[model samples]
Target: MTQYRNVILLALAQACFLATSMTMVTFAGLAGIAAAPDPKYATLPVTLSIVSTALTTAPMSIIMQRTSRRFGFRLGAAIGVLSALMMTYAVYSGSFILLCVGALMVGPFQSSAQYYRFAAAESVPADKSSRAISFVLIGGLVASFFVPTLWRFFGDLFEGVDYMGAFVFAAVVVACVFIPVAFLRPLEEAFDVGSDNAKEEDARPMGAIVRQPGFIVAVVNAALGYAMMSFVMTATPLAMEICRIGEASPEVIQQHVIAMFLPSLFTGFLIQRFGLFSILLVGHMAFAVAFMTALSGIEVMHFSVALIALGLGWNFCFVGGTTLLTRVHTQAEKGRVQGLNEFLVFSTTGVASFAAGLILNLYGWQTVNQAAFVMLVIASAITLVWGMAGQLRARRGRL
Candidate 1:
């Protein structure tokens, strides 16, 4: 297992694997496909796509246990290809509900893609895990660059043909994920399906493990950070669209997404230096900063920096929380506990994402930012309580 492990190839595969997330950028196409029959369902495509992934992630994990990571990823990518094709068919037929169903099928593929970072970590030593994870994240960052471009270019390509062009473009991105999943050299020490259950006895129930403060803190820290970021970032696009600050210039939105992913470049190293809790604290403060920066109004420059700061803050908290959560469980407990944690964490993000659009449309801007701040505060309070309780327990033990 002393392989040098070509980090570069691993990183590229992850980027390509993650590139499928850009399907959301194809919203215009989905919109056109749905607009004729059901205006209420116009946003359903992007929304349901996430819900689809959420529902399937755990089942996909089980399948991965029996299959090689390579094989599981291949299946996910293949489904992505199918989803893209289905999306094209939906567009051709102007089937709004079919587009949503296609989205549902797309979720498992994304669920499989979620493991790419873990694959990257397993490729290297413990010391390099953070770096490897960050390398994979680079893929996410790079997609932030092209997603909007794909959305816009494809939106323009078909013109009066409607968003079908964009749907077709998304299909191309889904197809791209297939090549990497196909050609990726499976990590040298990643789970071998045959040897996986060697320690099945060590598998603890989710309830018993999540009871640990470390586990609780890690999951909450993660869920809260994501929920808060989603709460705010979800609103920001609409908020800016309302203010007309950068709505006319689409580059502004593209730059905002770039800011979100760009900070990921340094998050792994930062976590290594400052410790996970420190990063968590910094993330809260950054969220606060992002919210405050937006209070002045949605100017392009103001929101641009705010969005980027928000994105970076999210990266630190999320990556830190993930790393810490990994530490709190044994192999036996890993599946159940990790599954539970992600379910809750992503559930929070989904609520926040959904609420962002709904709340912004209803209550206006100030209410949205204020709501995000409140969630951030609540999450931070939970973190502080966990840390303080741990310290008190340690002191009492000495007595």
Candidate 2:
């Protein structure tokens, strides 16, 4: 129980972090619409937020390595609070540029929050790492429930100021992150082969580490899985609008968000029981089914089912990929490896999100789903080959 204290606190911190994010996602676009000079740039604030996250991910990871996770997280929480206040001021002043700047400032918080799962994994023994990762993600599930209520209670708290009070609420939520984080105990060092100096000496070059088949597969599943999820999820509302089911979009998206994090409740247990490769294969199949279902129809039922499948697929692949990554790096290499992994994952996600709108508008929803399907097939094939090669190597060793 004592050993698990950090995990519990981290989970609480994750919930607070995600609640702030969900609030921003819910209100940022509407605020942008009100403040922007041109209607076309209404989503620019959201885009800038993701861009800021991607740019800072690697640097934040390195910073945590030099300092400590507690320090880094507190710094991120401070940044989130400041950014939320800036956004509040932006709404009050109706300044589009200031809103964008505030959105950009929030990225470090997102980047830092992403490490909660990794930190959870670090809190537990290696065999239980998958469970720790999944448990931390349950925080997102909690946030999905918490955000709507928060809005209902405070949506109009500032009277004439529109979303100004909501942004203030976001700041308060982020500031609350300080409480649980302040209690987090320091994480133990990763297991290494020898003395600390020898461990440092044994660290492989980045190129050499990334060249490993395991590393490549981990990145493919995590990065491409995230990209596909973002691409499809982002396009869903727009696609529904075209299909004349736009009114149902919110319910469908709500269900999709629920599907995404609900499975974290048991995903780690499934991984522990059935193994990573099998779960990953199921994730690939889920994506395939999702794309096919979307292609088959545009009805509300079809959209709901497709998005649900998409979310489930993302959970499996993302969790599996993260677990796999932990097995590949040495203690000395943890910081750079995790940093590079995050950088690639979010970079692809940022590109996929930005492209989703363009591709859907230009080629239609069918084409967007088809492109994602094609990418998934390519990534799945690479993963399959890697898994089989790993089995063959084990067989040869036995012989």
Candidate 3:
């Protein structure tokens, strides 16, 4: 555990990041509705935030590769602080355009935060990678439980301005990320540009690396799984608004957030016990359950159950996929592979988030759930093929 000191600090940083994220996720859509000219554009701010994240992920990864993670993380926290202030002003002014811009500015911060799990993985031995990743994610669980109370306390600070103080609270929380980041020790595998070891572990061409079966499986599960999760989650606040349960949206989202991270407590252990493919399969099944429950009704219970399942599904697929990804890359290829992987994952996520609003407005909640099926099928098929191929190889090796 002492050796995991860096992992613990990274987790603290993750907690700060998630607290800010939860505040935004809980309030941003409602804020968008208040600011947007039309109801249909209510999720535009949220979508833009994801878009910004997608755009910055690869660049941030590359930047971290060249610089230290400590430097990169501090830079991200500073950006988050600025973005949070921009959002506070946006809310205060009721300016939809400014809100969108603020959300876009939040991308780089989120892009940096997303690497916390990867950094944790790199800090530990290969066998302990999954547990380290899970431990860092436990920060989200802590954030999920506390952020709402913090928001409520801050939300009341400015009497006339609705969520203005909450954004301020977000800024403060984001700034707190710097505290943990300050103490983060350099990772064991930190890239050194001119080192003999670095030169010897020469990276393969991007195409060759991405073409591996393990890489394909990893990306498919993580990318499509995240896309599906974003698709439904981005639309959820609006769906609740449509159902006239707007006031309950926060509680539902909180429950979903909790569900998303609580499983981290034992997910790494489950993966070790059940095997990666089994966990991925279960994740897909959980997603199926979420869609079916969502389609079954529009009541608060329906929303709660569906979102909980969605969170669980996301946890399983994302964790398993990330663990699988670590196996397919050398230390030299880490930056390129991780950068490309995140670029693809968040790119799809951005698309899903944007489309969630359009689809929810045009077709309805049912269509949003229905559309996710296509991605789920693709993810499941590839996972199945990969699992079977591994089994065949093992059998042949035994012969």
Candidate 2: minimum summed lDDT over ten consecutive residues — where?
188-197
Worst 10 residues of 3 by lDDT: 187-196
For each candidate, what is the lDDT? 0.69, 0.82, 0.86
lDDT by residue (tens digit), candidate 3, 32-122:
8789898778788888888898888777867887877777788888998999999999999999999999998998999899889878887
Candidate 2 Cα deviation (angstroms), residue 153:
3.6
Show how many residue pairs clash in every candidate, following the order shown.
2, 0, 0
* Maximum-TM-score candidate: 3
In model 1, the worst 10-residue window by lDDT is 25-34
Task: Give the CA lDDT, 0 to 100, for residue 109 in model 2.
Answer: 96
Full ranking by TM-score: 3, 1, 2
lDDT of 2: 0.82
Q: For each candidate, give its TM-score against the true structure.
A: 0.83, 0.82, 0.89
| Model 1 lDDT tens row, 360-387 | 6677778878888888888788888876
Report how far residue 262 has shifted in candidate 2, in Å: 3.2
* Stretches of candidate 3 exceeding 4 Å from the true structure: 1-8, 62-67, 117-133, 182-202, 396-399
Candidate 2 lands at a TM-score of 0.82
RMSD (Å) of each candidate, 1 decimal: 3.7, 4.0, 3.0
